[model samples]
Target: MQIVDRIRETFRENAAMLREIENKADAFFGKKNLQTSLMQSITMLTTRWVKMPVTP
Candidate 1:
């Protein structure tokens, strides 16, 4: 339960960080730029998840 709670909290923090990044990207660039960069970021994150190592 404690580990689950910590994971939930970490996810919430990450969501907030992602929102801030999107806002900053949109402000400095534009919707199109934000879309492109966000797609790239998603791809990178997906790749990382796919390649994540498993511990025994």
Candidate 2:
């Protein structure tokens, strides 16, 4: 009975840790995604500006 309780407690602790890690990973990726999106937008705007003909 004691061994069973120990295993159950261990599993619960591991599950909580895993959830925390997953949340952190999700947040990290979310910021990365936002950065990527902003870079793409900047690149597109720069390309458009470069392609425009210069007027005196």
Candidate 3:
């Protein structure tokens, strides 16, 4: 019975750790996606600016 309790405790700890890791991964990817979107927008704006004729 003691060993069973220990095993259960270990599983709970592992599950908690897994959840924390998944949350961090989600946050990291979310930031990465936002950065990529911003970069794409900047690139598009620069391309448009380059194609526009300059007026004095």
Candidate 4:
């Protein structure tokens, strides 16, 4: 279960950073072009993460 715990910890850290990113993204929400760019980046990361099998 160590790997699972480690992955959970990693996700927790990412979640914390996402709070700040939320504020940053909010600042660019009104700009459609920038919003797309930010969303694309986020999507790319999430996609990569989802592909990894969480194992212990």
List the candidates' TM-scores in order: 0.57, 0.53, 0.53, 0.42
What are the per-residue Cα lDDT tens digits for candidate 1 across 1-56?
Answer: 99999999999999999999988878889989878988999999999999999889
Q: Candidate 3's residue-wise lDDT over 6-37, tens digit each?
A: 99999999999999987887697786786798
lDDT of 4 by residue, 2-41 (tens): 9999999999999999987877877767557677888999
Worst 10 residues of 2 by lDDT: 25-34
Q: Positional deviation of 55 in candidate 2, in angstroms?
A: 62
- Best-performing candidate as measured by lDDT: 1
- 39: Cα error in model 3, Å: 23
Q: Which candidate is the best by TM-score?
A: 1
The Cα RMSD of model 4 versus the native structure comes to 12.7
Q: What CA RMSD would you report for each candidate?
A: 9.9, 12.3, 12.7, 12.7
Clashing pairs for model 1 are none
Collision count for each candidate, in order: 0, 0, 0, 0
Q: For model 3, give the 10-residue run with minimal summed lDDT.
A: 25-34
Cα lDDT tens digits for candidate 2, 22-51:
788769778678679889999999999999
Q: What is candidate 3's CA lDDT for residue 6?
A: 100
Q: lDDT of each structure?
A: 0.94, 0.90, 0.90, 0.88
Instruction: State candidate 2's TM-score.
Output: 0.53
